[model samples]
Target: MLEHLGEKLILHVTLGNFSFSFDILTVIMSWVVIAVLVVVALILRRGLGQDIEEKPSRTQAILESLIDLLKGQLMSSFSSDKLARELFPFVSTVFMFVLVSNWLSVIPYCESPTKDLNVTLSLALLVFVMSQLLAVRMRGGIRYLKGFLEPYPFMLPLNIVSEIAKPISHSFRLFGNTFGGAILVTVVSAKFAPVLVPAALNAFYGLFVGAIQAFVFAILTVAYINVAVES
Candidate 1:
């Protein structure tokens, strides 16, 4: 258990003069999270094909509630219903992926992909790129470029720096929380009472903190895109 704190199982590959390496555990856990989300999405799709019932089943209720929740969040940020609907799929997918990835740590012998900086960074970069592309599409390329010169010409450098920092901060925020929680849980389980204390802590950190981090990441993605497309 103590070994789980900071150690990483790294795999290296080499071909002639080229070399590459990656964290094996993070890669496998990420695939596992993706597989879980895919299965759930299929289940939801199958459920949707059924005829409308007078009363919703548990699965139907849960699906409707989750969709409503995500839609509400998007609507709060976007004044245009069409725009909100357009962005819903990406934002909701991000929320589900992050939530599932974060929760993976709660399973025995399984770790969260978000605990790895690479995984979180990839997700953050995806959001950043998507927002930028949408901005350019909504605003002309010249207008998008001109956004950096807002208020004063001298602010261009500052604006550029701020834009660069978005993915860094976004990725690190989720990575720090998830990684720190894993370390704390491992230490408690190894040093203190292994059963009760660790279990309680895992529940709090895995479920509560994980959900909050996922929500924050999703909301921030929406907010960033909103800012990009706004005049």
Candidate 2:
């Protein structure tokens, strides 16, 4: 296990003369997370088939609180309630997916998808693209373009560089934290203390840190949207 600390299982395919290498572990783990979320969503949807309840069940109460929390974060940044309502599905999904991905480490023999740079970077890029599109939508194209030159004409290049750095920084922050936690757990568990130590570390890193990182990522995504529209 120690020998394979950072190694990935690659799946290679050849189509005619071209060959493609894919990180099979990351892909598999990512899909596992997605499938789990899908199943949960289906169950929840079926539950919704019941008549509306005046007083919420425990599960419903918890879910409502979570929704309000995410919505409140969006509403705080976006003054328009309609915009917040529209954006809730996306932001909430992001939070749930990431939170689940991070928590994957808690399961025995399962690793978090976020431990892979590709996964985190892809997520960051998705948010980056969405933010750019939102900016263009909320502030007209001309105004959005003009944002790069604000305060001083010479600031355009710097602004462009800043925009380019967002995804890089966003992705690396998550990748580093999750990957580092994984490595820490692996190394300590393999070479040092046994069951109890590893269990404690896994709970702390996989659950607590995972939840915090997910929330941070979601909040940063919302912050990017706020900057996009209000910049």
Candidate 3:
């Protein structure tokens, strides 16, 4: 059944007790996504002028608008403007990276990295680590750890379990939706000779469903950060 998955997918590596594996396609495709974003950023940067009153180029305006949107979203989460600004780079980067990764499936020779369990889990784990660090930094270490016992000391274990589950749940939600979409499209395309059907399916899956998952993942990261930093 896995034979239908196009190209060389997984590669395993081992070194003593440290065993590791990754999707070969995901790694290659993610670089392309990053390069494209970097190029767009450079082009947008070129359009900006030092003079405030000068009219901005379309690319500059669009980039500025996106930044504004991200800023507003982050601002809504944090009480401190400085903290919000500090977190904007992380939130915005995740949003753009995931968005690009998802949309790339529409192009030939590219697949959404988010479809890979490893990729989604790694992304989710990043949020988990950052949120925990933010909590420790904002609230003192002892206070942050002690907060798990809130409302009752007996809840500590349950709270810790729930905290651990956040990343697992976050990762699987994206991986399942994206992986399932890819599998369904593949199976249907292989069985049907029609070109239009597969094209439409790809379009809907790549654009609508993929984009929604990316947006949710990015926004949820910010939401988790908010919960972490909240007093």
Ranking, TM-score, top scorer first:
2, 1, 3
TM-score of each: 0.92, 0.93, 0.90
Clashes of 3: 0
lDDT of 3: 0.84
- Lowest-scoring 10 consecutive residues by lDDT in candidate 2? 46-55
Give me the displacement of residue 83 in model 2, in angstroms: 2.2
Per-residue lDDT of candidate 1, residues 112-156 (tens digit): 999999999998999899889988999989999999999788999
After superposition of all CA atoms, the RMSD between model 2 and the true structure is: 1.7
Candidate 2 structure quality by residue, lDDT tens digits, 82-122: 76778888888888888999999999878899999999999
Compared with the true structure, all predictions reach lDDT values of 0.88, 0.86, 0.84
lDDT of 3 by residue, 71-146 (tens): 7765566767777879888888898888888888888767898878888899899999999999999899999978
Stretches of candidate 3 exceeding 4 Å from the true structure: 6-8, 12-21, 73-75
- Which portions of model 2 miss their true places by more than 4 Å? 53-58
TM-score of model 1 relative to the true fold?
Answer: 0.92
What TM-score should be assigned to candidate 3?
0.90
